[model samples]
Target chain A: MPPEVEGGETTERVLQILSTSARLFATTGYDGTSMRDIALACGISKSLLYHHFADKDEIFARITLGSTRELVQFVESRLPEGAAPSLRIRAFMAATGEYFQRYRWAWIASTTAFWNDPQQRRQTERMLWRDRYEGLIRRLIEEAIAAGEIRPLDVPLAGRLVLSALNWMHRWHKPDQGMPAPEVAEAYFDMIFHGLKR
Target chain B: MPPEVEGGETTERVLQILSTSARLFATTGYDGTSMRDIALACGISKSLLYHHFADKDEIFARITLGSTRELVQFVESRLPEGAAPSLRIRAFMAATGEYFQRYRWAWIASTTAFWNDPQQRRQTERMLWRDRYEGLIRRLIEEAIAAGEIRPLDVPLAGRLVLSALNWMHRWHKPDQGMPAPEVAEAYFDMIFHGLKR
Candidate 1:
């Protein structure tokens, strides 16, 4: 095999392990899941798994880091350059809900990892992505206010409210049930932009 | 001591243990905390602690149950016999924010427990309170719609959004920090009632 192809295969194998591990961890939880379980779930030997990850925590950390990075990138990628602030906010929420729906295990694993493990490295990485994600939303809201699209309010608190509503989607959103992400996002945007009052 | 006073003292002691355990659990997580740690924190013997509750799980269950009941009662108490739908919704959010602030530990413990442990009984109990709480909010929203106070939207999704914003308060709301519960509630209610539009 060519050198680049060999490297690509290795990367694919590693991603496969991480994906399987995330599913297992999401269902059984981090503490309940074992390395053997992950290896078994991935249909790989324990030795092969060890070759890729030092241990379960390493696998978990990698999964969380990758998932967070992917979510931020996905949302950022969805935004058009020089978009209006309202358009930016709408795109962000719609993309986020869709991302969570498509990558349910990643969302669950990343969320669980942040709360379950307080290791310094994991904490720093989690906070980095969290701050970036929240920062983007805050900036959009600020722009909206500056442009006179939305009324001025407590910026930090408003950011928290917006992010909280979006993040909570993972908990109740089921792809097979209820409104799809696009419709849900529309409802959210409508309520958010128009308030509940008639 | 009189029988009633003796019973009250025992109840108080149990509550004290639970309160201390909740604080420890919130700070150190459930797995990080032990019976010995809770006993030591409560300045009581392990036997005395066991006498009131069978185990840590039992203590946790009682704490969660009590906290849920108290929150429901508090919110209920805050509403008058026949208030406006908007008033009812306002009372619910304000009371919930205040309840979370006052019993921060309970909120932390209960949330952590629901996510960390998948015990059937605990799941059922958590859902019971959650459903009741969400149901109340949904009913209030429905009433608001009928009263023509708020425009019709996805009721369930709106409930989730509202609850998410309020629940997320526990993560960021510090009594000694930036915005107090009432002020935060005001901001939330305002944003919730009126859209971001100028």
Candidate 2:
């Protein structure tokens, strides 16, 4: 049984299991931890865990979906259309970059596993994210091109290039090292916007 | 127990094992694989596996070292210093990015768990690579700035930013998509070096 804080809804319980699972999964990789371990860690019985989630696969899919939605919402809300192309691009990437700081493990796990045994759910998640991110970047490239703020390049490929830079933040960034996510994002934004010029 | 293929002292068996293991480690993740499986897949005895590599960790170390050396060599070798600053910067990033295409998995693996692990050997490899890559980048940036190619910005940070773009290639690129790595790098090189200009 999950904590009463989740109320009596099974979906809430599933979500609870998922949140706890993501935290645990992030620390211990998916293969290293077992369902029994997850159930024990989450304070739920095996049957109840099964009742809420069919298996680890189901839970991972659910968590990934939630993560994708949260990312989309985060970026969409942060974007101010009326801003200059440069500013808009900064805001856009910064929001996503900062969000990655909290949830870097998801990226760590998902990105490393993109080509390996991509389950149907994982494939769907990949498509959704790639399309959404590419679409957002397409707009940025278009705006920048129109304003002559940046150089003309393939929007989809350019988006991939920018996303690649932001994606690695989780790999090397350490919060205790005194760098905040927003600051790192700004550094990257500065690199993207102005480059290494005085 | 290991097939001694005729070739260089490294041996075809050695190369086969390395390439296969690299893919397995990248796909299944290091934590998910076992020596038994690797041995079986390579058609070698576990003892033979040990002959070629001490153990799983050693294999991991070699892969990291091998890929890093390849990267360091490629960057240093391909970046012609006498070229114009604009051309040099673009060529430098393009060559580096092109490396990401074939060894995308190796690059991603080296930069993450291999770098993050507290193990001394991995750490040493990480530092070696960090210094080798960053040192080259610093030299290039200094030259470019002195030559009045780009505005003087933080060289170290700019190096990291540029690298992040190239490293993320493992996540999004698909060989089946028909876009060659060189072409991809060229496209991104234009975006990074020239910016969005008419």
Give candidate 2 misplaced runs (Cα > 4 Å). A1-17, A39-52, A104-109, A112-118, A147-151, A195-198, B1-9, B43-50, B81-88, B102-105, B108-120, B176-179
CA RMSD for every model? 4.0, 4.7
Query: CAPRI verdict on model 2?
Result: acceptable
- CA-lDDT, candidates in order: 0.78, 0.69
Write one digit per residue (lDDT tens) for candidate 1, span A1-198.
111212344477787887788888777777778999998998999999999888988888776776777778888999877988988888988888877877778688777555557367776876798889989989999999999998987788778878778766766777788788766776787787789888
lDDT of 2 by residue, A148-170 (tens): 88766677777776777777777
What is residue B175's positional error in candidate 2, in angstroms? 3.6
Question: What are the candidates' interface root-mean-square deviations?
Answer: 1.6, 3.1
Index of the highest-TM-score prediction: 1
lDDT of 1 by residue, B1-198 (tens): 111212344466766887898888777767778899999999999999888878888767766766776777678888766889988898899888888888888787877665555357866876787788889999999999999998877788888878888877766677778888766876788898887778
